[model samples]
Target: MNKLKVAVIGCGAISRLRHIPEYAANPNVEIVAFCDPNIERAKQYAETYKGRAYSDYETMLKQEHPDAVSVCTPNSLHARTAIAVAEAGAHVLVEKPIASTEAEALAMIDAARAKGVYLMVAQNQRMMPEHVRAKELVDSGRLGKVLTFRTSFGYSGPENWSVEGNGTWFYSKDKAIMGVTADLGVHKADLIRWLLNDEVSEVASFVGTIHKGGTDLDDNAICILRMKGGAMGSLAASWTYYGEADNSTVLYCENGVMKVGTHPEDQIILEMRDGTVERYRADDIATNAGQQSSGIIDAFIDSILTQTPPPIPGEEGLRSLKVVLAAFESQTSGKIVRMT
Candidate 1:
């Protein structure tokens, strides 16, 4: 079997921590190229991973002609990079908030479709073990219909997670575009949409910059979502979480309530209307403090190799992104934004 030639753009923290390592672990993948604006960083990764490094992605794409590429660039660059990769006839696994705008995302999807290649968004939360089990429980009808939910994702800030630390592009409005809202909020938006298998029909939000000083982007956001199925929920994303990162969700259903990622030992907790309680232990949820395989790379590789659509395809990503975008609109307008 010919190993799938893969390349990574933007040798940032995400590339170093998740994309490169995950690809290296896949027996079916061969790292062929690495690209970053900082050529030295790219060269370092190339030296360690046995790939050629380039400062320009276009040059790398032209020369290497990889089978697939991971677009780990800043949020604003995702669309342009992914569209170029698709046009180059390579599959794309782009980092989340797939594009800065819905129009950009649609263009990327169209490019991939026209080129007969796959375009996947890296929404890793859906692949987390605990979330997977929670999905199963929800689908099993054991928890009945989810009527309400509260999902939150919070951490110290991107300064702690990014390779550039305090100077990371995450703190730049032009580069990041949306701070915690896009960085962390999109994950829960995707997760909730996927977990309930429902669309968010309406959104109202309060997004603001609370603690962070360097950037004008929001450091905290609280959004209220109304699903098409009549289920309602609140989603919070924050960079103001002082101590440990919190990625937890609770679902109130007709028959019971389900809690996920709230406890250290038991990742999922269930309370029944019949006065019964259940606990489940799954693999720990991946966080900056305790990193784990996201399963995104493997799934992206499998989709390319099998000639199937990716699990989190461009459309699904766009759907989740719409929720985030709506929240932004609601925050600015002080009114509920309804999705059409």
Candidate 2:
């Protein structure tokens, strides 16, 4: 394809604010079609971005034959939509928490692999500079064997941030499946795994709907995680952070603690065993309100253009979702859940 044609499935918040804008900004991408259950929303995106609107994704895929597709649907629909996109001979970029269940995620991964198509998960935090630096520090051995870690991601609940204000699809048990844990928690889970270069072995968690009083979904989640590398850590994802968002991670190693976006001023701070400290500043994370170049659009387009493997592939996303799923199991069974 000269300039890769792109189709977006689901014209929701993520689709409108991130995927659409980013793809529209990329010179190498031409958005040809938009599909959403809400036809009016799809029509709006189509009118603004120069695309045809369809209520059904299959029809859009068949009609547009886009070179790439962004699956920005709800938590429950990711696997089916992405798999279909890949089967239709298009590279797919699915939003995070790849699917509601491990089996579904695995199936999606298998389908893309079988079709010999690139299937990437939009785990955008991996593109954040602070996270990039922290992962570098751990890999550099400056931390002297990470002994323990703690990470948190929080914001005012999706009720305020979703496209539907208070009555968003995010709170629907039928769509979101799991609450804050699956929403925000999965992002941190993916980040910690990348930063530590290890997978989770076991998870014991306390998840609840503490602050969002009216919702049946959980507003907060705390997971005690044991990494495969024999290090332990705590992961918390919350929607109860009433103030500004707190997205931070701290790693305590034999040397000292390393903070990533966790400090008051510094974006990256490391204190050594000998008492010396190093600090590094990184760019602010991109959000829907103040959207900027996150490198996701570029990366996805590059992978398709170059026929290279995706940076955050389906398996990588599945690994992160597995931890979140394990936490849910732990919350329900009142026991530590061991990951496969």
Q: State TM-scores per candidate.
A: 0.99, 0.96
In order of listing, the candidates' clash counts read 0, 0
**Model 1 agreement with the true structure over 290-330: per-residue lDDT tens digits:** 98999999999999888888999999999999999999999
Task: Determine which window of 10 residues in candidate 2 has minimal summed lDDT.
Answer: 284-293
Best by lDDT: 1
- Please give the RMSD to the true structure for each candidate, in Å: 0.6, 1.4
Q: Write the per-residue lDDT of candidate 2 for residues 1-340, one digit (tens) a residue.
A: 4789999998888887789999999989899999999999999998999989999999888888888999999888998999999999999999988999989998998999898999999888999877787788888986788899899998888877888888898888888898999899999999888888898999999998887865788889999999999999999999988888888888899988898886656889988889898989887665545666677878999998888999999999999999998998999999999999
Q: Flag clash pairs in model 1.
A: none
Q: In model 2, how large is the Cα lDDT of residue 93?
A: 94
The TM-score, computed over Cα atoms with residue i paired to residue i, of candidate 1 is 0.99
